[model samples]
Target: MNITHRVSLLCAALPLLSGCALVVNAAPASTATAAPVFEQWRETQHRGGDDLMTAGLGLEGLRASVAPVFSSPALPTADEARRRAIWSSWRGIADLTPGGGFGDRYGSVQSAPGREFSAYARIPGARHPHRVLVQIPDNFDPARRCLVATASSGSRGIYGAIPVAGSWGLAHGCAVAFTDKGAGSDYYDLDAKSGFQADGTPATHGALAFVPEAGTAAHGVAFKHAHSGDNPEADWGRHLVQAVQFGLQALDRAYPQSAPFTSANTRTLGVGVSNGGGAVLRAAEIEGDWFDAMVAGEPNVSIAGAPPLYDFVTQAALLMPCALLAIDDLPQPPVQAQARPLWTQQCAALKANGLVQGDDTDAQAQSARQQLANAGLSDGALRAGAFSTGFDLWRAIAVTYASAYGGFAAGQHPCAYTFSAVGADGKPGAATPEARASWWSEASGIPPGSGVVLVDGNAAHVADDPLRGLRCLHALGTGDSAEAKRVRAGIAKAAANKPRAGLPIVVIHGIDDGLVPSSMTSDRYVPQARAAGAQIAYWRVTNAQHFDSLLAFPDYRKRYVPLLPYMFAAMDQVWAHLEDPTRGLPQDALIETTPRADAPLQPAQLSIPVVSSR
Candidate 1:
């Protein structure tokens, strides 16, 4: 039977098995205009009717609501059946490590005598194994099966899995499972090496490796490429797909029928934040049969293409530095003055390195070059001089951070300063191939023909507008080749497709999220799903930052922690709809809240307007 038919059958059977209330609400009707829905939702909220959470509730209120559900008794028949189904499909390719710990670490329940264990699943084509942490509840029953929530981590690695697993999965009486998804390091290592060898070379058994351009400063920072697996499995999309598929299989194997896991009664749910959020979405699209429900918070669904690359460079070179400097108590004027001279020097260095062939008159170009050279010493010398004299503290810190995160060496870093120039509109301008080349050469101090391969000029996409030119460098050999074709197909297969008819999906994003812009969801994903007639709910939270609520940012924690219970409760409602089809799909609306640390989660109404893709 088809997926929708199967889901309908399951829903129909649910009533017979447990007297479950099947609420068959009609699908949301299509509208010609979008603004009315937003207004209507606002009206509803203002009316003070029953929503997910009541108005004026505080932390104590949140705890009171959540405690009971988590502490409830098990459904033995359902749990046992679910556990059995999971093990029946197990591949047994993973090894389970015993767990012993206490208290909360990274948001997971601290188990004394360790209820949590690590299962390492070996990927068929990759060198590194995928790691899944399974946290079993205290009240374990061998005869009962439990719900499973598989969480994926963000770019920062498995630490991103803690908040959701703790607040949502564990608290909801479900077994919380998390995967490293192959990128196990704290940072995205361009070099395959993550775990170090005693002899100092990258350990041969590290994550898969991706090839980097030889002449770039980003090269040789590590021992191996963790993303480059054998051929078709090399890309991240396929890795995540494998991680989810085998992660479940491994879990079934680890908790056998004789133990507490019975797949027959179990239902799988997927949840993730940031990159992990993207993984869950992709997994649902690729393997809808595997997951009954999913929640993705601020998922990075789009690839690292031209637009994102541009944003990445601009944020690193201009936006981030300014923010960091401000936090350091540096005045804007002096910092701007320091930055201008540094930018000029970088432009001159690029010209000198034969990277920029001046198209202007020889005299004009020469005068411009002289003017820039005379502005001040290069950024590297300035930073060194500042550190030595204890001057320009903000610039020093800004440059250091920019270099570290932008994947370049500190001092005379090209990528850090190459795109710092402002255009007529006062935004950062794009760096040309020659400029990028100059920056790389200066940073590495390597000559043009000295065995280092430089990026081709064509690869540096030039646009009429400098802002348009801002893009991250694309992966080498990402087009037309056999491997490239395979990677593209894999990514397309795993991307969020037109949602299925009955499967309910709730996507929550922060309006003020700096990392993955909310527009990607509100503008792209939601509209596509809506157009395709999928049961989708999109929540745009006002004034919420990307990492807020999930991470321990003191300001965000105060404002966002109280909202977690409500958010999870909404998700639970969606899951209920999946099983009974009576709970109705969640309404798409804007979640409004004051920025105050003590403010409650007061969701106002706003509809996602359908806009044509840019």
Candidate 2:
């Protein structure tokens, strides 16, 4: 497992280049050699009926309402878990359907039969092991060696970025490397005193992906990101580096004669979305040019100057529901507007609590909107809060990240929040047989996904609302308590080191991304990068937002375009740049995309520019 075995130095000129000069295999580029403690490794071949990218489900199966069934409900096979995970991941991440240019135009479902090697590898200090999977396409060309390393978006499991990153890499005959980045669907069942074994089946002990501390007072269920007590975000960059190292090592092992495929000769690109995107950007800063280029789409990157995700998310969690009322005629209102009754009560609660001014819901709502606007929430971002408010995503995010930043043990979250399988009364309890069985396949690593839910202990009466939790979470960062200090310290560690000025980065963001707004994210990061003389390309897409899957809803489908089309375009252009140094980064452009307005998608709706290969 030592990464040092494959020392290579084919590119002698790299040592002379001013900006692109890197550790040209004189030594291992990362501390990955010291870690990646693999517990179990499994290799499988995919051909004909099943394949690497789709897991044999293809596009039609991906869109089906129900997931692939486990042969035995109680004891599902590892292959079943893999297929269902891929299916759920695709549904969670991609904006498929002809209306979004998914089926007929882009986001093709061609199968790539390949060999897959996956394992649970523990980082040097992390308690829970992260999942890493590498896919070597059957048609892989060793002479034209190419590798794409990707991270899971949000807290999604292993195949989270498969739709966008995996598909593109496989189609181009490149090896695809994936890492859950210290967070995945490796749930630990607290009540059963059990956790997931290597292949997603339950086990009482022995080399499990996660287990709560022996004496911790966890209630129902647990997952790594919230309970690992490692503040895994701090080491996200290392995770990406480890995945890349693992991939290269796996490739060398697979084709021994093809031998040492180091960064010196192989072209490696890193790409991802949301947290995955952030991981790639963070890796570019820390690792010694392991990647030749990177593309980050709607990434939730945190740095010294930009406010942390918890800071803004907590704010929106408190005010967004009430504020959403003031915005009139949102495209996706009906699905969320059912919460109007609760929103009115929330507005009244805010006024009584002195959080906002005015007696009536209208005035209170407007005041709440203004307050969020002051917190760097763009008009689109404020409007976009409707989805979060409806799903209560902000509340869940605030609690989950607070636990991470504080490095709390399992079930030790502030605001009395806990991860669990909730009963009908919204109380944490033991999981049902079915919930536990399918969790590895169905759950996103974040709670409120699949069977697991985020329970607010303070608000037993209001299961749908988490006002008390939001209040505590909002005040968490600034308070002088020991927990707050711990959170602050961890935040410092998690802040990404400013990328080297010469590193090539292409950042693609939607103008209306409410989850991680550009005003607070890309707008802040890009200028700092450019000021430092970084070779960065910025693409701003109109009528696009962070979550493409939301487009399946009738209203959302009409107003927004998927970001994947442009993400692919940027990848193509960046690949060209990497192929020939003369092809410079794409000029910063504001793409005016056409929304899917109750009609089949035309390539014209995407408005992809002719990326000249001059």
Q: State each model's C-alpha RMSD to the native.
A: 18.7, 6.0
- Overall lDDT per candidate, in order of appearance: 0.36, 0.79
Give one digit per residue, the lDDT tens place, for model 2 in 1-614: 12354322322222112112112213223464453334356667788899998999888898898889988886788788889989999999987765567757676678899988776655675666688889999999999999999999999888888998898899999999999998888888888877777777767777676776735456777788888887878888888877887778667756767878776777889999999988988887874667888899998887686678778888888888889889876657546547889888889878877899987999999999999888788777777667878888888887778888888877677678887886667566778766788888888888887778887778774644536667788888777888888887887788876776577898999999999888777877788778868788888998888898888887887888889887788888889888887786676888898887779888888888665546
Q: Which residue segments of model 2 deviate by more than 4 Å?
A: 1-3, 6-37, 214-216, 333-337, 424-427, 460-466
lDDT of 1 by residue, 541-566 (tens): 76555533222223333333222332
Return the TM-score for each candidate structure.
Answer: 0.49, 0.93
TM-score of 2: 0.93
Error of 1 at 325 (Å): 12
